[model samples]
Target: MKPRTILLSLMSYLAVTATAIAAPEYSVDHGSYNFGTVTQGKKVQHSFTIKNNGDATLQIKQLTASCGCTAATPSASSIAPGKSAEIKVVFDSTNFSGKVQKTVAMTTNAGKNPNYTFTMEGIVAEELQATPRQISLGTMKAGVPREVTVTVRNNGSTMHRLISATANSNSLQITPKIPKQNIKPGESGTVELTIASRSEARILSGYLHIVTDNPQKKEITIPIYGSAAK
Candidate 1:
């Protein structure tokens, strides 16, 4: 064969190899969605469109979300070239308040880019609000009492009352220091809690239940965790 013809053939082979290397491509119509504001105890959903813009088929192997409160589903498992599909995402606002953000990940068969992620964000409005939803007692010494306070506020236009407060463990004591039994609109009060451990080296776990007049969240449980050391 002629040297010039051999060079031409080598150039054609390189071009074909480069084209094969860039076959499958994955893309989404939008990378994020914002629900703006959502009501507490309600469920919201949104759909994101996924497109296969390459020469080969795209296969979605798995779909996952950051938390159980969020769920994602793909309309079709495989997408043909130049075709698009929908990924429906649902966010449960139950037991969630204030600003929140969640992510959904998609595992695909696209080469060099097997994982794709999208985010959803929104604000949850609640009639009643609690500060520091989870209370941490940190490390406490045995036989020593540790006191912490939690504030519950009424954010609605109507009046609400603190029906009762109780703790799962006898070692935990709860006291209400509010000026009035009923919490007026936009009013707030604190609940003082004292906990102690009997063993010198032990782990203590309990739940503090607070009952209120709010219909949606009539009762809420706060987790109490502490380690007692010498």
Candidate 2:
């Protein structure tokens, strides 16, 4: 073989090898975790690891959770070439019940694949009522009377009575009829809440709590929301 031809072939092979090594790559050790069964009013945590096998540094541009109940913290703000990092995830199980599924997404600075995803799953007991179970009375147009209701249901088999009712503040009035004691199983009842905004609030809001046999729902405040006409 000619010396010149041999030199050319060697250069070609080097170039191909360099190209293969320069490709950017990233991966998460595990994209999912199973929490199995968790009780209500508790919390759970999991972690995922990522490695950068490419020739460039990797940056996590953003992290978003599907729900506010979940959160995360990663060890690496930016990963060095041929390096790795860890991302920790946390979930609040308060008031959530019966098979919970949540998702979290990570956005990266790597141009090729900018987004990655992960999932968490577990079962929650029905003992916790969770939040937003109550109703809110938002702003009513200045002069209009605001009448909103809070729903109370006996999802459990045990009979319960609304011996008393309450609102977060004195801005509203709530009461349960004395004669209407003992709500049977599977029965749904409403507590009439009357709120006359002493002053025009762009938004009127508060919590309504019902006293009942349900430990989960006992004194649970349901959020109320209404916006007064601007």
Candidate 3:
């Protein structure tokens, strides 16, 4: 072979070798975690293992969580070829109930797959159950006061204490305050909402805010609806 031809072949081989090792590949053990059923105010955590399958190093650019209730952290920001890292995720179940889902996303420098996402899902059970979630007075006579009642049942394994019940708007007044009460497990309590008479008849819209000793749901709001007419 000619010397010039040999030189050209060597250069082509180096070019191909450089291209093979220039890109990175990212992989994970799993993409989702199921927390099953958990009580409110509980904090759940899980760790996901990440691996670099390509020849180059995988650089984690950014990590983000879907909401403030969730937090995501990485053991290491970079993973070399054939190495692994861990991504820790935590989800807070406070102020949440029923079925809930949260997510964590990460950005990387991999060529084919640069973005990855992980999910968490579970059901949150509340200890205190509120009946008649809202108050609907419909239509009332102007200058005539009325009363409304809400029942709170303890459905969990512990007792719940009722702190106070108040109105957010002056149009809907809470007269003759309801004293605090202790609700035992499997028992229920009453929260009476009294509406005061309005001198000027108009549309009424406000919320009845309730304070409780339940850590899971420290504060609850009940929408109030009604109108006064002459």
Identify the leading candidate in terms of lDDT: 3
202, model 1: CA deviation in Å? 17
The runs of at least 3 residues in candidate 1 whose Cα sits more than 4 Å from the true structure, single-residue gaps closed, are: 1-22, 131-162, 166-208, 213-216, 221-230
- Between candidates 1 and 3, the one scoring higher on lDDT is 3
lDDT of 2: 0.70
Residues 130-216 of candidate 2: C-alpha lDDT, one tens digit per residue: 234655554455555655555555555567776666666434333433335477767756676566553536556666666665654
Give the candidate order by descending TM-score.
3, 1, 2
Q: Give the per-residue lDDT digits (tens) of candidate 1, residues 92-190.
A: 988788899999999998986889998999899876777768877777777677778878888777888878777885444434343445888888866
lDDT of 3: 0.84
Candidate 3 per-residue lDDT, tens place, 1-230, comes to 99999999999999999987688898889889999988778899999999999889999999899999999999999899999999999998887888999999899999998999999998987678787888788888766778778888887788888898877775666553555489898888888877864776477778877788987788778888888875
Give the lDDT of residue 117 in candidate 3: 93
Question: TM per model?
Answer: 0.61, 0.51, 0.82
After superposition, the stretches of candidate 2 with alpha carbons farther than 4 Å from their true spots are 1-23, 128-230
